[model samples]
Target: MSAPVIAIDAMGGDFGPHCIVPASLACLAEIPSLHLALVGQTPLIEKLIDRQPGVDRARLQIVHASEVVAMSDRPAQALRGKPDASMRVALEMVRQGRAQACVSAGNTGALMALSRYVLKTLPGIDRPAMMAALPTRAGSCHLLDLGANVDCNAEHLYQFAVMGSVAAETLGVRRPRVALLNVGTEEIKGNQQVKLAASLLRQAPGLNFIGFIEGDGVYRGDADVVVCDGFVGNILLKSSEGLAEMVAEKIRDLFSRNLASRLLGAVALPLLRSLREELKPATHNGASFLGLQGVVVKSHGGAAEDAFQSAIRRALVEIHENLPQRLHGRLEDLLL
Candidate 1:
């Protein structure tokens, strides 16, 4: 296969080019076949590139985007007002086939709105959903609709299940166990929407439908693909992140109580470090906007250099797997 080219929205995140530039350059250095198009104000991006020594100018190019989508900008404003925004320009590159994928740390709403408008959705997919691999006890699991469609009917949830299953399989899960996120694992526990979605999933041909999974079951790794509406998924994800941070801080506080505790902490440092590395959000920062006609990966807006690099790497993996095409093929068999 040929080397993949990725378009990076260098001006989309909180730190903009400062973080993205180094991340892009590091990815380029590590993967000689990778090419990057940094989209932002040409002069500013050029200056950053110039500051970094031994950069392979041949593989990295600048794509000028006169405007930037602010984090506070609403989706409608971003779609209509900023025609030349770095986020839009990068997605446009994917739509126009100028790049195999687009990676951005821009406003989530803007990115989703622009992605749907620019790339459209694959056949049989009503809307695009954000999917990410989160750390779980059984290694990891793919969670979807992470804030895409807040209001979803049973049909929409059903589609998310199919799409999520395909995504997991592509990522190396063998017939992944699919489950619906609900108040309880019992069939009579959830609201009307969850019950209806569960019914639809049960009937999906060839799907490894494992019934309802409570929120706690997610981390326990009870299912390989957890399906829920955007509202529920987003809240679950945010709460998990906050809880993880709090626990980590509490651990540190306990370790620093006294000299004896500090000594114990020293002895346990390596194990703690390993646990932190496994659970850190930055290690799993990239979230794929699935169902789009092309590949688009969203990095956390506050992502640091390594975190942003994880997002770029996610895009590269999708490019290599031809994720959009795989979904298209699977949808034809499952949906159509």
Candidate 2:
């Protein structure tokens, strides 16, 4: 059977045509019977298509968008001024049933904001969280509200646990472990918000709550789901990113110091590659803006072609899995 179609925001990321074009081509090659609605300037997308060798030009169509939302623009203002933006057009395609899902490596804040304004949240889901799977020393762990709603309440966090739990189920984990990010593991050890959230989650039926998870809990691999509001979560995400970058830089520096270091590096190439594979953020390029009516993946700003391809592939799996329908079924239980 043919796979469902997807809409791609062709003009969103730092690299724009350079990254998006190759990524879409890669996606088309991998996903048989997949169709794409290229949401951007029609002529630009056409020009890119014309240059590719042995391309199945019929599989792609251009949906012209007039404006582009800048990475620096405020979400509210950008949405108001750029109604015909590439991201907006891509989302509209999903809304109109012309596409199964929408993927973009663009303005994350704008994407989350517009998705909320355009798609709205499901019942009992007041705020949608930007959830990402972080690569850990043990394995990959889930972190919610990476940079979406900065200030969230205890109830919002509880809801995130529910949504995150559903995500774990879709990802094939049974009875997923849930943990609240706090300063302490004690039930009353956190701020008033976290304290209240702890009580709620503890009492929340259906969720496999494992109590409070501190910052150290993340690296310790103590929980499957790490829960926090956007502000705190964003900080944690950036902190992890910064540390990863630092470690990679340090490794490179160590390997570049004259003949002895070079020889050591050459001898350990396979080991280093294995470590890189485990540490690569781009291994999972797309993260969903969960709680929307349909699947929406947001890629990294500087995502390379490989990262973009990985993201599109992830979108395909999410679409095929019918995550939304399943999530809806699990909603009442999620709403505690």
Candidate 3:
């Protein structure tokens, strides 16, 4: 098989090419069969590549993009105004079949809008939902509609469940357990939409359809795929990130309080480091825009070298799995 080509928005993230260029180089070194197209201002990307000694130029190429989508740019503004934006150019590469996947740490809203405009949704997919893997006690769980469609109907929620289930299976789960994110586990609880969506899921053919899952149940890994509206899922994701940061800060403070405690901290340092490695958000930094006709992975705007590389790895997995094709084929049997 030929090497998979990934298009990187070299100017999208907070650190831009400074971090992206090096991360791309690192990924190239790690994956010998990978090829990259660095889409951004040609001169700037070229300068970054020149700084690294022994970079395999044959495996990397630069695609010039005149404009950049700012982190603060509204989705509409980016779609209408920035035609030559790095984010858009990278997505275009995927649409044109020049690359198998596109990875960007650009504006999330802009990315979604431009992606819909450029690639369109797969058959039976109304909107492309954002799906990300989150750490869980049992292992990990896939959550979808993370800030994509804030106002969704029962049908939309049902679609998210199907798409999320397909994504989980692609990642190696067999008949992934599916659940709806609700305020309470009882069927009597939750809004009208959740109740209606649950009804649809229960009747759907070939779905695991495990029933309702509360917020805490997500981390407990009660289900392999957790489905929710973008509004709820975004708040849940941000809140979890904030709580993790607070706990880490508290741990640091506790160890630095006194010399005696500091000595004990030294003793426990190895375990703490291991725990941190296990739970670090950077390890799962990419979020897939599921339901799109092409593969596009979104990285956090503030991602550093390692986190951005994680996003690249996520795209590579999707490329290898031919995720868009799998979703399309499954939707025919599962949705229609």
Please report the TM-score between candidate 2 and the true structure.
0.94
Off-target runs (Cα >4 Å) in candidate 2 are 280-284, 334-336
lDDT of 3 by residue, 136-233 (tens): 99998999989999999999999999999999898888999999999899989999999999999999998999999998899898999999999999
How much lDDT does candidate 3 score? 0.91
Q: Model 3 reaches what TM-score against the true structure?
A: 0.97
Stretch of 10 with least lDDT, candidate 3: 275-284
Scored against the true structure, residue 58 in model 1 reaches a CA lDDT of 89
| Residue pairs in collision within model 2 | none
Q: Write the per-residue lDDT of candidate 2 for residues 65-134, one digit (tens) a residue.
A: 9889888889997789999999998898888878889999989999988888877787778888887787
Once fitted onto the true fold, the runs of candidate 1 whose alpha carbons sit more than 4 angstroms away are: none
List the candidates' TM-scores in order. Answer: 0.97, 0.94, 0.97
Question: Which one wins on lDDT?
Answer: 3
* Residue 49 of model 3, lDDT score: 88
**Candidate 3: pairs in clash:** none
